[model samples]
Target: MTKVRTINNYTGIDTRSAIGTVDHPLANMDHAPTISELCKVFLKDGVALAVNASRKALHEAQLSPLDITHVVSTTCTNSANPGFDHFVCKELGITQPVEKVLLHGIGCSGGLASLRTAANLALGSSFRKRRARALVIALEISSLLVRSELDSINDSQDTRIGVTLFSDCASAAILCNGFGGVEAEPVYELLGWDNRVIADTEHDLGFDVDPLGWKVVLSPRVPKLTSAAVSPTFNKLLQSLPKLPPHYKTASDFDWALHPGGATILSGVEKAMNITPEHMRASYDTYINHGNSSSATIFSVMDRLRQKDMDKLAPDGKAKDFVVGCAFGPGIVIEMCMLKRNMSHIQRTLVVESGEATPSHTESERSEGEAGQEIEIQIEMGSMEGKDEELGEKLRDMHPEVPQQGDSLSEALNGVELD
Candidate 1:
């Protein structure tokens, strides 16, 4: 117990959520729950969480259930026959004949992978001259695997720190093609993206299936390996975009929405990119508050970056307009995307009225404005709903205090170097 607490403290995660707390069925059990039991809990609580997230996203986009023409969902947790997205669609009263895509085996990068897939689908719809509104969802119920992981740790006496790092979450986003007549507000313009796998590092990270549930396989070298790949991938992503201001050449110039895989991973990336902690304020905040919720963590970080309080927390007391989104997964795969904040209508009008040079817009933006093609992306974190309200309320009640730099686990792992 002492060792577990110490390692968890090292990870800097204050709290995380599972299916149940006070009335947890497996709390008093002598052994880890069977796969059957875990599935039952996922079906009940997991589905509800995904539904809650989807509802919130739909409400925020000001669209009805029927407005969604395609559904793209990803998960490293559940493997049902019809998939959770089907149930989510049913619960949200989306009975239309919508195309559905369920992505598996993408791991933590699944969120961005799903977004990339949705963007392609939206583009295809645009080419076909049809309106398309694709809903992308990423959900994970990692907490249930805790007992199984503990059992592995106890039996093998292996220092598996993964048990202390994962939690549960569901996040959703709405992406609409410019062909539609609908006027939607976009938080970020999808400018360009890049995905690549580092060579000879397959054994470094994975999540394998187990009878009890699944087991996380993390190598100590992961932080070093993942960090080393960031620079090249980020450069490739930047090159894919149209000509931009010279100041955007480096990583620190833009804001970041990086998946907080762990304390070391975050620090390693910061060091490799030569970015300040303030550049990834939301990533660290999400890790400290929610831990790593697999594929869902990236969206949480992105959502946090948009909050008013986050602006006050920025280095200059205002958030940057250009942002970078990055995440890593099992294959040592790195996903990177360039995003520019969509100027609100009022902001655009003010710039025009003041006779100031307007900021550069992506091709998608110009299409939406001039060619009547609008591709709007809106990402949302799931809200507490149904039985999960108890967990949500508890989370809200807790205050998240950012620790000082000297108190961070990063210092301990700062010397980790790649082979």
Candidate 2:
């Protein structure tokens, strides 16, 4: 137990969410749950979480369920017939005939891979002169597999660092084609993307299925191998997007939204890319607060980077307009993308508030008093709302038997260091 705690401290994760908490029936069992039992829990809690995340994304995008033309989902934790996306669509009232793609066998990079797939789908629709709004979802219920992993560790008497790294999360995003002709305000523009696999490292990282559940095959060399691949992968991405701002020449020039595979992974990538911790502030913050939630973690980091508070933590106290998104998966696959921040919406709002003449509005639409009142309302809303807490509550409600806060594994490693 002491050794495990020491190793877990190196992960730099303070806390993480899991499905089978300290009080869950599965946690109390003497052996791992059957495959059928795992499937039941996944269908219930996993699908519910996916639906909730998708609804939040659709709401924020101001799009209706019917507006989603395609669904691209990924998960390393569940492999049931019909997949969880099917139930997510049904629950969200998206009854329209929509194309759906579910990606499997992909580990941590699944989120970015799903986004790449959705981007291609959106581009295809544009080429056909058709409108498309693709919904991308990544959900992982890794906490449920704790018992199985523990059993394996005990049987082999070998360390499996993954047991201390993974958690549970569901994230969703809406991608639209520019040819849609809809007046949509996008937060980030996907300029370019690249995917590459490092040579001779096929066995270094993997997620293999077992009779009990899925087993994470993580080699200690993962951080070093992934770091070595970053420079070349990023160069290729930048080469493909030559139209980027002149000031953004290298990795350090732009902000980063990297998948927090682990503390070492983040630190290695930072060194390889010649960037600073401030460049990946959101990634560190997400990893420490939520741990690595498999395919769903990248979106959580992206969401954190866009928050107003993150601006203060940006390099030189000013956030960059461009961002680099990177993640690594089982095949030692590196998924990278270039994103340009869209601040037109915020700029336009500021212009209107200052009573300045703009192309869209010659006069102020709202009085100064009304504008101030609206700002106050938004501030109050932001302060009162906690997205993670709300989602945790919903999951706990769906599975009342599982305690949401305390993790059984963490309890076992009673002396684990937490930030």
Candidate 3:
């Protein structure tokens, strides 16, 4: 049943390299991959990435084997019977009697959607029971399906542009009522959740089944449309908040966890919210380094951003920083969450029940040393008046180790002059 022959982490990003790779068998043949091949790629990419991510989360949470009570997964790439959850359970060795839910066709918005579901299911408890935990994971392997058979201009710049925006990645999180460690970092408190499907724009974005494989139904009007509409939707979410934090009147108050769907998408959301690179640095970095990894992209974004302006619980059981996580998908849907930095896991857990926990995901690790090395550059807002290349160049000079846009695996490494 093992479809993967090997693992070669060709992509520059180390985290994504852990996931397996796929090949377009028909690229050179100028034909479609047999449906069997497509299915095989889908299963392999989804299952492998899911298992790797789950294992990482388990290790980080220090969870014992067979301890997870439920597994929630989302994917729009490929699917089959016995599904990804079944594979994850067997591979991760979760005990029987575990609940399973698979969300399909949700597209990029599915990650936060799955997180919202997990949080709702795990509500009402501030302490973990042996059987009361949920693991949420998202896999988007759309990069594996690029075949010239489907595009009118094979390997053309525009056709290949999608690969630069969509990538293959998987990310997971362990949601419990509470964790024992207040100092154990990287636990994201589920503060608030919101979602909306934009009316009359259903066809604007979607995935459609086609002969070659899944056809991407993306419209060029996406950036402008989303820019104009998303802010209102975000405002609606804030209005639905049970209780607003002090002086938190606009989107500027919360750091954004945008999907990094594309450069335009990221910039569009940034412009609409009146935020800047510092506010959405993770989103920009994810796009430049990881491409748009669909639903899994935000997990990477949050992970990279774990320690930025974060802190532990105050004596009063609230956090200083807050974040709003969001993703857009085919239904023209917007998946959103309001997260705050937690001072203590158990303390915040109690506050969550009382609707007063404000927190962010602060990974329990030394904030200094290696963790601080990857910190983002702090630039003043509206300082980005240069062209795209100029901005990219400035970012590159700040971190010369970061590979440039046209960097191939070898080229990216070529600049790594050894000591």
Q: Estimate each model's TM-score.
A: 0.84, 0.82, 0.71
Question: What local distance difference test score does each model get?
Answer: 0.73, 0.72, 0.57
lDDT score of residue 187 within candidate 3? 50
Pick the TM-score winner.
Answer: 1
Among all candidates shown, the one with the greatest lDDT: 1
Task: Please state every model's RMSD to the true fold in angstroms.
Answer: 9.2, 11.0, 12.9
Score residue 24 of candidate 1 by CA lDDT.
74
**Which stretches of candidate 1 lie above 4 Å from their native place?**
343-374, 382-419
Cα-based lDDT at residue 209, candidate 1: 81
Error of 1 at 150 (Å): 1.0
| Regions of model 2 farther than 4 Å from truth | 344-419
Tens digits of per-residue lDDT, candidate 2, 199-279, equal 887787888888888877656567778889999998888888777778889888999999988776777888899987778
Q: Residue by residue across 173-252, what tens digits does model 3's lDDT show?
A: 77754433222344566666777777787777777776566766656566666667778777877877757677777877
**TM match of model 1 to true structure:** 0.84
Query: What is the lDDT for 204 in model 1?
Result: 74
